[model samples]
Target: MPLIPKSHPRAKSLLIREKLVKGFDNGLVAKEGLLAQGRGEAFDYLLGEKTTKSAKKAIRAAAAQILLAERPVISINGNIAALCPKEIVKLSKQTKAKLEVNLFYANKNRKQAIIKILKKSGAKVVLGSNISTSTKLPRIDSARRVVDKNGIFVADVVVVPLEDGDRTIALRKAGKTVITFDLNPLSRTSQTANITIVDNVTRAIDLLIYDSKKLSKKNHSSLRKIVDDFDNKKNLSENILEIRKNLTRGAKIA
Candidate 1:
């Protein structure tokens, strides 16, 4: 990977790309994960590559939801492992959420590689590697359905960053509050999740951790109120409007 200068217009985005490429080379990210990153990058560009006000609201709600959950699990995949492993570990510690390595492109080698990254990043016990203890999530055929019984299988709230649509819907049907990070506000994962942070995961994840810690000082009733006041559909609509505004602003400049 080449050194990205701070003066580069797309320095942060370029750095993220380089990280994913390095991850693929290191066997931490799959080939498909590279394609997924490109798709997300397009949406991030539309979002002005920054966290919006609506995204901050959604992040607060997601933090409240996670804090209020009886069992909260942060699901990990190749992209997430490659992008924000340390932040995820810190979040797990802050919110007492369990870290589980769940992947759409599941395989033994990839699973071990993700687990190793998480462990190195300070995650003590990563789940989703034990086949014997794993159980199927109903109504999903993807390899992501295989969840550890102690982790996502029993979680009341799940934070699935860069998640798939099918698993989000399936998790909702199973009566879990799903919080997801998806840059595409129009994606199924965005629409179906209980709280959708329509921001780049790399940017929004640290905010989630900060919010979780701040909200921790509040009582359960306060946390519940925050979650109750949020509406995912409405927030997504606001995000779409924001995108339109960004495009309009850019058009004027051009």
Candidate 2:
């Protein structure tokens, strides 16, 4: 299908629907793809396609972390581009993070799609991946097989938008800090990320950017410790229990 006209009034929705098609083809996505889309749309609406309180915190923390890094790379995937290409570009400017395409379905066409959107949004970084992309820094994991790359590889921080567990593991092994957005706190991506914002991407990204605008060059060492201290499994269980408890109380009230 032709690329959706980004300038058009319905461009955002059109892109969202198209990415859903690509997401299903990628196959690693959750089984409830349609349901997820509906939920994300609702979240985008609630957020007014802008920032939220929690998301604002997340963005500030993320930008501060990246700014502290000697090398920061923002990993852009199809879903991220489709959802918030403009914001992604803004983030690249804010954090000085290189925009790189790292998706489950890495290919020529996919790279082109990523580049098209980023460039359209005025992001300066060229197309690149774990396998082949021009970088003075050495390649760590080519062919997308390895769990991690080893070296002072030019990315101390990696913002993995729309990520999963496998690559998140790789980033950890590489000693690179990861910031992610995940609604299902139980997912591996959320569990492994150094900073996990448990919310929809549109809301999360906007908040992060908003905070990015306000945050200075100061580091967030204390916040990093908090994030590290939180256990993924425990956090997920707590979230689930809270939801269940609230639902049970609501049932009693009814």
Question: TM-scores of all models?
Answer: 0.98, 0.68
Candidate 2, 73-153: lDDT as tens digits: 777766676667898899888867777765455566666766777898998764463444343322335433321232124
Candidate 2 yields a Cα-based lDDT of 0.63
Model 1 bad stretches (over 4 Å): none
CA error at residue 11 for candidate 1, angstroms: 0.4
C-alpha lDDT (0 to 100) for residue 144 of candidate 2: 37
lDDT of 1 by residue, 171-211 (tens): 99999989999999999999999999999999999999899
Question: Which predicted model would earn the best TM-score?
Answer: 1
lDDT of 1: 0.93
Clashes of each: 0, 1
